[model samples]
Target: MLLRRGILWLTLCLPLYGETVAGRWHAAVKTPSGEEAYFDLEVNHSGGEWQGMLINGRDRNVSSAGSFDGRKLRLEFNYWDGRLEADFENGELRGAFTRQSRKQVLARPFRARRTPLVSPASAPSVDAGGEWILDVGEGGGKEMWLASFEQDGARLQGVLIPVSGDYGMHTGFVDGNRILLTHFDGIRATILDARISDGRLVGTLKGSVSAMVTGRRPDKAGRQELNSSSLTTMKNPREAFRFSYPDLEGRVVSSTDARFRGKAVVVSISGSWCPNCHDEAVVLRMLYDRYHAKGLEIVALGFEYTGEKERDLRQLRLFAEKYKLPYPVLLAGTTENAQQTLGQLRNFRVYPTTLFIGKDGLVRRIHAGFEGPSTGARYAALQQEMTQWVESLLAE
Candidate 1:
């Protein structure tokens, strides 16, 4: 009887063991490679329920699917397929946190505390302003990356662009001659660190993995810019874009459908696991709302990481429902087999390859990758530029 009473008392005490995790926390994941990523976490507990948000710059990702057993806490992202499982002890939340992407199953050691880390107050030693041409190492797959920075005093804001896509907006600072920048949306986290060495900047982009990258200021004596429009091209530009796929409901949707016959169409080739694609989706929503009634038709070709049709559809449905997308999204295929599945395009490298089609049913322009809101001014300009393209096609 005495032993049973002790066991029952221990169970009862477990419920009261965890302290209230209801405050702003400074959270970070230190990967096995010693690289680190941080994000602002705001948690609230009310009515015996716990919820929170993972904040990265201007994005606030909601975590509503949660459970707290007093000692252990598990919170799932509202839109993405990522979760945080932590134990409350020593006045800190410590556990393994996965990347927000459904394809990302690797969990890293995540720790959070009430206090935030302080940034260095020293002034920058160098001005990291203007466009840079990066020559990535062989391990990264991509040969080049275009990066632009806006620096104000010691603070730095920028976006890293690859041939296929971009690492969303980054917020960081220049410590002496070193540049540090980071971006953590609900989907992924990318940290950049570079140092000036002999009129050149060299660094490594690190997250769950690391890749060496070296860059230099644009030489006016050569190609000053990387044209994203020229990256992915149709094997035969004279032919129109064509595809037939099923949506979440399993109904076939074809490019030849009468609904799109006479309309100026925008085809977004993207994946559910891609963060930059999410950024592009937000802008697509705005453009669809404005020009949808003006003879503009938009469709999304979803290529997911997992080939499982049912699970991919679930994620796609959540993405559409969360954004309240007015257009149809078709599951084309798996991301790994995209090049083979989308046989018409050969140089396909990125998640979000946007193709604009005129009323005549021909692809007018194919813009590879997207500049999301975190890109600041570039994002604003992209909206105007895309709108103008649509307007011109509609006018025809």
Candidate 2:
């Protein structure tokens, strides 16, 4: 009876011994460009299990698992290819956000503190909305983000559309001239803090890297055509789209294989280390499931950063398994190797350039980059466009 009582006492005391990391944490990381990025994390417990949810822009990714080992807090986001390890003390967390790849591990310093919710009630003086253009970097290194914001009093929700893809959905509140937006998706965390002055928005894009940002309300011009097929082109149109590479199990697969012959195939040139590639994979999976019986097949040609075959294969396997990809993901070799193997193509500039081939095995369309779900109407439009294109091809 005494031992049972002691066990109960110990169990009760455990909670008092450690600082609970529950609730909301405002986190920041310094990027290589000497900029600061920020995000918010909400930690909770349910059914005796601890988990977390990451909010970045409009994207919400739930944590696979999270645990606190008295002194250290560890959160695992398996699908996003990264994890966070931190030391909890004095009501603050200090550690690093590590992005894992087969070739290297990139880590950025991370720190967070418990903070009150940034809600509409707390921010009562903000009045800004509509579409804006976010110009990041400068000169040849410049990139633009088409942002659409919907503001209801102090509450704000919006999406940032970039060339590679959109930053999903972002939510936050505005405080006077200062507006704060954040998104966290297990693997990637982004925070935007901007100030409106003289009808111009100035802020910073913070995450693994930080960059200065400036924005202004767009003119009467429509949304820019950020994605174009001309971004990646073929050097020789007559050359039959062909490739022979080994799958995860070392079985040689080729464009002429029986599984793909006489079918509409999409050759996705991608890399495991790329977030954009992950987005493309998600869309490809949905398309394959919807049209596979209609003579549709997708072959993902992974152009891994790591030149080592074994390591690259491992990464591809992880990617395929995580997404439960039904189609074959062949290692077409490293990024440099892709240039040589796909010699018929010129100036391959993107990680997820998609090549659509008709039933005749001739390349029909090449889509460079991906818009993803963050682009709102553009994402839906692209989906509709691709679906219609596929249906047309199948009918022919």
- Give the Cα lDDT of each candidate: 0.79, 0.77
Off by over 4 Å in 2: 1-12, 15-19, 33-35, 46-49, 101-103, 116-127, 171-214, 221-224, 336-341
Taking the tens digit of each residue's C-alpha lDDT, what string does model 2 give over 312-384? 7877888898799999999998886677877888877767888988888888888877777776777888778
Query: Cα miss at 45, model 1 (Å)?
Result: 3.2
Question: Cα-based RMSD of the predictions, in order?
Answer: 5.0, 3.9
Cα lDDT of model 1 by residue, 121-151, tens digit: 6778888877888887666474778888889
TM-score of each: 0.86, 0.83
